[model samples]
Target: MAQLLAEKRDFDFVMWEQFNNEKFLENEKYEAFNKKTCDMILTEARKIAIKEMLPTMAEGDKVGLKFEDGVVTTPECFKPVFDLLKEGEWGNLGVPEVMGGQGAPSFVASAVSEYFMAGRSALSSYVSMGSGAAAMIQLYGTEEQKKKYVKRMVSAEWGGTMLLTEPNAGSDVGALETSAVKNPDGTYSITGNKIFITCGEHDLCSNIIHPVLARIEGAPAGTKGISIFIVPKYFVNDDGSLGDRNDIWCTGIEHKHGIVASATCSMAMGAKGTCIGYLLGNENEGMKIMFNMMNGARMHTGLQGLAYASGAYQLALNYARERVQMRELGQPHDAPPVTIIKHPDVRRNLLWMKSYVNGMRSFYQYMDYQEELSKIADTEEERALADGIFELLTPIIKSYLANRGYEVCVQAVQVFGGAGYTKDYLAEQYMRDCKIASIYEGTCGIQAMDLLGRKMGMQGGKVFMTFLAAIQNTIDEAKGLTELADLGERTQKMLNKLGEVAAHLGKNAMSPQYKTAFAHSLPYLDVMGDTIMAWMNLWRAVTATQKLAAKPKGKDLPFYEGQIKTAEFFIRTVVPTSMGRMDTILDMCSAAIDISDEAFGGL
Candidate 1:
């Protein structure tokens, strides 16, 4: 119940010290917000998150969602909390002011997201869907569409969603059965059944705007033929008032594991033969338009992962500090019992969780800063470089944080022992909620394939090499410290060896042995993720080392000292196992690919 969603001290450390976020304000776009303004915003956000949203997490889970009479009803507790978020305009914090947002930098927005998401991840879907859908319209819609939708959506007066997933075509989106036909009017008649649509039928807003994907009749097959359409629950008139209800129907909602308060609906369009929709962009450019939302959602999903992990870790750490257990090792049995935090293995687990939570948090901040930099870069080359790094790290952030987040949940539960497994605690719920992060957007395996199959070869691998060089630069800077020099040298060696493995796998992906290359892609992705984690840890250490050298007084001393210890722990303890795993990947084993279907068993 005591959820300190995110650590404020560390947040400011990374924002001000590691990232130097004030530099972002030089661009007039963000000049309205200085350090004091950003810090105040963060403070206000924390207050709202704890005061309004934190209480809704359990209520939503207990009451859950209802889909009786073909109408999805959310928890009673959610309405007021959602109203607060809407009133505060937190739904679209990072967008430019012209688009009716606070115009906060992506890095600052990430901090707010961490706070809000940690309270109740299920409800955060409403905010994500609203922003994602509105962004699509703002970027690709006509002036009329923008005027009608963007402000309302950003203000949370209207709810929105991405309607891509279907029953027959889950990840293979090209195989969708939805069809679109041009009508006599400018709008088109959309006929499709979309499943797993989040925020598809929420009652928090007056109208739910759905960005649906369907194929135009007689268009090309596969993703190319797909087109995006604006299928609203109720039509909007030219004057911006709500029109007659469209043919959109929420036939049912899924009874899922976690985030039970959020509706995952089976949406029926044109079931009554009256679903009217307007084309978002040019025909057959649906994938192109949708990628913007997809990529952004992937990054948001990474934030959710970190939120879950951070909350769980905090809970575990608190429990460990309070729970009395056996005496310290090497002490007599008659000695006073020590807290579980003093237990060696428990300490190991807490440190492991801490290292990842800190690394992932810093990585999120860094990734967001890069995104903001890309938007405001002075030089074409700098923008392009940031763009490439963003692309390369997007999948990593989503999959790596998700997988690691879930692991952190498991450890948290272990720290709490039996209570963590019971309903009395929060660890189980965090694990259940975190599972969707990796599975959604794309599964871990899919992300792994995307990394090796697409991003590695993109722009002749220049983008990925740029990413490598960024890591190398961090290593180069950290290599100067007498204490951390050894870590720097070892990390460089591991990364250089990783490049070797990447080259070997890259060649194999093009060669006749491609199946084997793809088979080991997951392991290769793990290697890359850990290497980046090492980079983030080392990056933190470099700043911490400089601060400690200054002999900071009071709380600043411990904060800086802890950053160095976290970096040291992750680099020396966690990364060695990761490096050893990469050595195995370098060997290019074919056992997974060579084994026949019968050998896999239970076919």
Candidate 2:
């Protein structure tokens, strides 16, 4: 099997052709970068992924993590890979140079992360949490906080974790019981037990910084009263050196189904009443401050979905091309057995994986571009639109991409038959690892609610309408192209149905029949995801059509035409079924709401 993380040609096409990443060069923020420089950086990232990081995948999975006496140790083989990520500065790809980073654009950083994550998501978790912690400090922490933590986290001299989920508080963060008491020195003495803390306690770094969510004494009872605190494993001196250990300990690590090398810990703070935690933001503003990090984490989780799916698809593709099983459906019984790639059903599954993988890539890149636009838009209106659309799509991008990415992983396993189910192959591991992406961060159901309940009505629905109009515009563009006209019509019809369903559900959600409407939220989200994918594929096809029309002399004819074909397959084969789901949502049947508790009988 070819060691694949991502297809470079596809990456180039998306960056140079579809997205025009060159546009960033026009902005002063990116004045130091150009096409060659960006490409070279990506090339180096790829080398690091394939050569250095890839070797740790199986070792980490097989050896997993060891928890003993409150310390978590990852696979011995991973120690070198962890160091490589820090020394090569892969963890600081998007941070500003002033903060000791490479200052890459979001899209470029996303691309690099896809490769690194595809290499070893478990190890990548340590880097991700550290970088996320640094970003939060950079955005909201006081100057002293930034000076103390940001550079160290970005430099990977220390790692970090977001300690929000407690034993009693997972999805309902408002129900947390952790308490923070103010001490004489103006710092808080944090006391709490947080569960599901990824990289909570690891030997890879000398120190770990925790952004803990706890209720300050006399604060309100719910999420409104929560505050964020930065509690480091080792206290820092006034002159920037390590001091005595803080009152935090890792009780134990979970033996997870996969990504086992990443320590998922149960952490206890202030066990000895000495956990010195400095306030991250103002009291009672923790959720607001945490959003700055949660939003980014959601996006990165979406990328994990894409990365794992890509990993499975890559391995499956290689296996299919080499593993012969039976003759083609139409071939003679006496004929030689062909590779599974020649089988019709195998081909169908491959195309399914390819289409969704392609859509996910485009979706993530577009989201990253929007994030950049929110920062660098030429006008206030442009910035507002970028921010609104980004807010609207974050849930869908996170949940929808994860759902489909996992589906792709399942299909990859199917492509490999028995081998895919066995430990000899990585497909099962991919499935196991990707499963958490949908569950944590926010479950698909939670995301669906966010999409329908909040995003749909955002800014009196201007964002929703604007997004729909853009899809319509693309549909109109593709409708004029002779070869793509049919797929364009299919996509347009899905858009109209989706628009209607969104209005129906959004309106009903406010009425007395909210449960009935909410019951269908996940289904509605699926329909929206399908429509968005149709939009992405159709847009890609339109780009390919126009490019082929202008540059007919290119040797890359097949690749361009494949784009059109992929769009065609998705429109004809995928979008139609999603439209049926739209019909189901429009029906608004009350069976789920009306059914008695006993109907969901004994397990």
Candidate 3:
């Protein structure tokens, strides 16, 4: 409960020294927010998280949402926390100012959200959904639509949910069975059932605005026919007053593995032939419009992973420092029992978790900075390149961090031994909460396919090479530090291997042997993720080294020294493991394809 989201020095290093976020103040859009203002906002958000949200986290999980008589009810403890979030106006930090939003930079918004998420992931669901919905309207909504919904959503007077997944269309969204029929008055009647709708049916807010994907009558089949509609739980009168309830009902609720406090409902729309819906944009462009929300949700999912990992790491570290165990060699029988932190293996695991968690936070923050730059870049070419890099890194950010972050959570539990598996401790819940990050948004396999199959070839490989070049820049900068010289060298080697794999896949994409290349793409993604993370850590180490050298005996000396040690741990221990994956890629293993349907019949 002691707000262990991110260290102050680490956050400052990332914000001022690493990304130089102060430069954004020169732009008119960010001129209203100076470094002091942003820091103040972050501090306030952190306090709200630690005080209001963290206290109810365990209670919310224990007394999760309940569904009966077509209504979903969250735990009693959630109301005050939700009220605190709305009253603080933390929900509207990233929306445009005209719509009652503060228009904060993505970097600051992401950092605040990361802290809250670290405190209570389930409670953070409503805020995340609201922000995603507001972003959709900002990107593609008409002026009237923005005026109608965006303000309410941003202010948290109303909530939002993305209704895309159906019972049969989990991953293959193209196969969605939802349908819509247009009426003479310009409104449409939507009919469908959506499953696993997070924040789908909750009483935390007065209204819930759902962005549903459905196929209009007479439209083409498959993904091209899908359209997005704005369907609210309660209808809004022309005079801007709340009207009668719409016909969207929660038919059931999912008994999920984690985030139990957030209602995951199975909703039936137009079952009573009265679900009125408004089209968001042009017809047959629903997928394109939904991408805006999807991208935001994907980034948030990565942060969710970060949050759980950070929480688990902090808890495990605390436990290791306090829990006593038998002494190792060179200790007398009379010697007092030592804390587990004194063990070499325990230290290794703890350091590994710390290194990866810190590196992931920096990686995610850098992505947020890139997102801000994509919108505020001075030149068209810079904007275009930024957009390209965002596209290429989206899948990596989603898949790599989620997958590896879960690994860290598991390691955190491992550090606790048998005690970690008990419900009496929070580590079990942390592991459960982290599992959903990789599955939702998009599965790791889907992300790997997107990264290797599509993103690698986007814009004729310009984007991919731009990404490689960025990492190369970090490597070049790190070369001057003798401590990181070998890390820089190994990073270059991994990048070269990545390029070779990319070239092989590119050349064989159209050939009969393409399947062989595709078989090992996931491994390639792992290698790529490890390489990029190492590059980020080395860059951090180089900066920390300079700071440590400047003040030989200051209070910050240990902090800087820890940064260097974490970087060395990651580069030396983790990067070497990727060599096996690189070899696996070159071999073009087709074992997955070789397995037949009968082979899995045992399930």
lDDT of 3 at 402: 90
In candidate 2, stretches whose alpha carbon ends up further than 4 angstroms from where it belongs are 1-3, 551-555
For each candidate in the order shown, give its overall lDDT on alpha carbons.
0.88, 0.88, 0.85
Worst 10 residues of 2 by lDDT: 550-559
* lDDT at 477, model 1: 88
Alpha-carbon lDDT of model 1: 0.88
Worst 10 contiguous positions by lDDT, candidate 3 = 1-10
lDDT of 3 by residue, 87-130 (tens): 88888887778778888888888889888987788888886587
Which ranges of candidate 1 are over 4 A from the true structure? Answer: 1-3
lDDT by residue for model 1 over 516-556, one digit each (tens)? 99998988888888988898899998999988888899989
- Flag regions of model 3 displaced more than 4 Å: 1-3, 599-603
**What TM-score does each of the candidates earn?**
0.98, 0.98, 0.97
Measured on C-alpha atoms, candidate 2 has an lDDT of: 0.88
